[model samples]
Every structure is written in C-alpha cells, then in structure tokens.
Target: MAFRQTVGKFLGNHAETNENHLDVSLQTHYYKTTKDRALTVLRNFFEKNEKFRINAVSNERGEVSASIIKGKKAFIVGTVIMVRPHQTVVDFSVTTESAFPFDFGYSTKVIHRLYDHMDKELPTIPKTNR
Candidate 1:
C-alpha cells in the first residue's frame, strides 16, 4: 500500500467493499442464494441488533441503510445484488461520524465483523464454485 493509503486506512472514517479493494478482506463476497433471500437475511441482521437503527431499505435498489450507535455513530449501507441464479453479491459501505478525519480503521473493522456474521448466516460461494 502507498504511504497515503496506509495513512488513509488509519486516518479515514469511511470504508467500502468492492471487487478491486486493495485489502483482500474488503473484497466483495458472493453467496449461493437468491438476492431476495440474501437481502432478507441482511434486513434481519440489522433489525436484531439494538445498536443499529435501520433508516431505509429499498429492495428495488438492493441496499439497506442504517446507523449504528456503538462507541461512535456510524452509518452503514449493505447491498445485495444477483448476478445469476442462486448467485448473489454482497458489499458494504461504512462511515463513522467523528470530529477527527480518522476512525482508526473502525469502518473496515465493522465491515469485517459484518462479513464474519454474514458468512455464517449465508452460504458463501467460493471462487472455484463460481
């Protein structure tokens, strides 16, 4: 990682998952399930968490937005999209609300924590499976 990127990773309050994420753990994840099912599980995931206050959910847009009030307030958006039958992709965007520009990689850690739960709740499709 570049010096700036290294600094940003620690000094930025925002983190997002995508296909081209520099961090391997931050890469988009795929599950062997329909988009609807994946989204439903995601919705339930947020609903069951008291720290998370769901703001909006749009099935048509394939995204769920929520604010988590833990140590610091943070907004998160999780997206589930279907590429084909029984193949769904999941991604997340998180931004912590803080006076400082950085959150000490808190956003990235949140994504990882979410992915850990999602991997157990949903059947993940390995690269070989796809």
Candidate 2:
C-alpha cells in the first residue's frame, strides 16, 4: 500500500473494492455463479440484515445499494457482473456517516463483513488478473 492509502485508512470514512486493491478484503471477489444469482444473494443479504436498509436494486443491471442503519449509518453499493459462464464478480463500496471526519477504517470493516457473508453464501473462485 502507498503512504497515502496507509494514512487514509487510518482515518478514513470510505472504502471500496477494485481489481487490484492492496487490501485483500477490499479486492473484487470472484464467485462460481451466474450474475443474476449473485445479485439475488446480495439483495437478500442486505434485506435480511436488520442493520441494512436497501435503497435500490436492479436485476437487469445486477446492482444493489443499501444503507447501514444500526451501529453506524453508512451507504453501501454492491455490484455483480458475469465475466464468463458460471464466473461472476462482486464488488462493494461503503462510506460511513460519522460526526468526525474519520471512522478509523469502519468502512473497510463493513466491506470485509459483507464479503465474508457472500463468501459463505456462494462458492468463491480466486480472482484472476485482468
């Protein structure tokens, strides 16, 4: 990780996953499932979890947005896309609402938890460099 990322994570309110993020938990995840199935799983998770309030969901786009309303108010976006048959990708973006400017990596932890939940719901395949 870069110096800026190090400091930002120490006192940041936002975190997102990408193809090459240094944080493994913040990297895009690959699952052996169809995009629609992956989207359904994500939507179900956000809806079932009392801490989350789902904002929007698009089955056609395979995207879902939700807000965390319990411990910390935060907005989260989940996206799913199928690269190949039975190969889907899931990514998350989370931003915490805080009185102070920083949440001390709370957003990152939220993403980690979401990913962990998804991992348990579906079979995961190792992410491939692209």
Candidate 3:
C-alpha cells in the first residue's frame, strides 16, 4: 500500500476583541512518505514571510504541524493538509470585527489571493474510492 498525505491552512482575525492581532495556523501530513519534505515546505514559508509569527511546530507519528500569528487588525490565517504521494487539501478564511468601508471588495480580494496561491502550489486532489 502507498502512503497518503493531508495538509490544511486556516487564517482569521478578531477585530472585535482586539484590533491588533491576527491568528494563523498551518498543518501538513505525510502518511506514507518521509516527514522532511513537509517540514521543509513549512519552515521555508515561516522564515520568508515577515507577516507570520510562528507559534508552534510539532511532529507526531506521520503528521507535521505548525501554527502562527499574523498581521495586526487585518488578520490572515491559513492551513495546508496533504494526504499523500498524491493528494493535498487546503481551507482558508478571514473575518473582522466590523465591516470596513470596502469590506466586500476586500474580502473578495482575499479569497482570490487564497485561491490563486492554492492553485499555484497544491493544485486540487481528485476524488478516489475508499
């Protein structure tokens, strides 16, 4: 049997509670492959992105996980879960305490950026029979 992988990313902000903090999380899984590849991808992202402040990274069995904090007021969070030699899944979202003047446009741009990044990086996994 071949190994599989899963990756997830989540991003959000709490403008109501505190307008100066953003929460971010990233998680990657390597079911049948080595953990090094996942770790390398995650570590490189953290190191390069000044907006992200890594909170944690842990490995348990076949999972490689990471969490971080990002931007003040304008929160951004993302997660990446890979299910493996062939599958990768990602989910990302954002929220604010009060809607800004250009809230609709802003949100749309954010979503677009997220989708673009995912498309460029992970692509999409095809459904398979269990």
> Which candidate gets the maximum TM-score versus the true structure?
1
TM-scores of the candidates are 0.95, 0.93, 0.40
Give candidate 1's TM-score.
0.95
Ranking by lDDT: 1, 2, 3
Clashes of each: 1, 0, 22
Predicted candidate 1 versus true structure: per-residue lDDT over 44-125, tens digit per residue: 9899998898999999989999999766899999998999999999999999999998899999999998999889999999
Please report the candidate that would top lDDT against the real structure: 1
Which residue pairs clash in candidate 2?
none
User: lDDT of model 1 at residue 52?
Assistant: 91
Best-first order by TM-score: 1, 2, 3
Stretches off by above 4 angstroms in model 2 are: 128-130
Superposed Cα RMSD, model 2: 1.6
lDDT against the true structure, each candidate: 0.92, 0.89, 0.37
Which of candidates 2 and 3 is the stronger one according to TM-score? 2
- Candidate 3 lDDT over 15-68, as tens digits, reads 111112132112221122234444445445656766554444444432222233
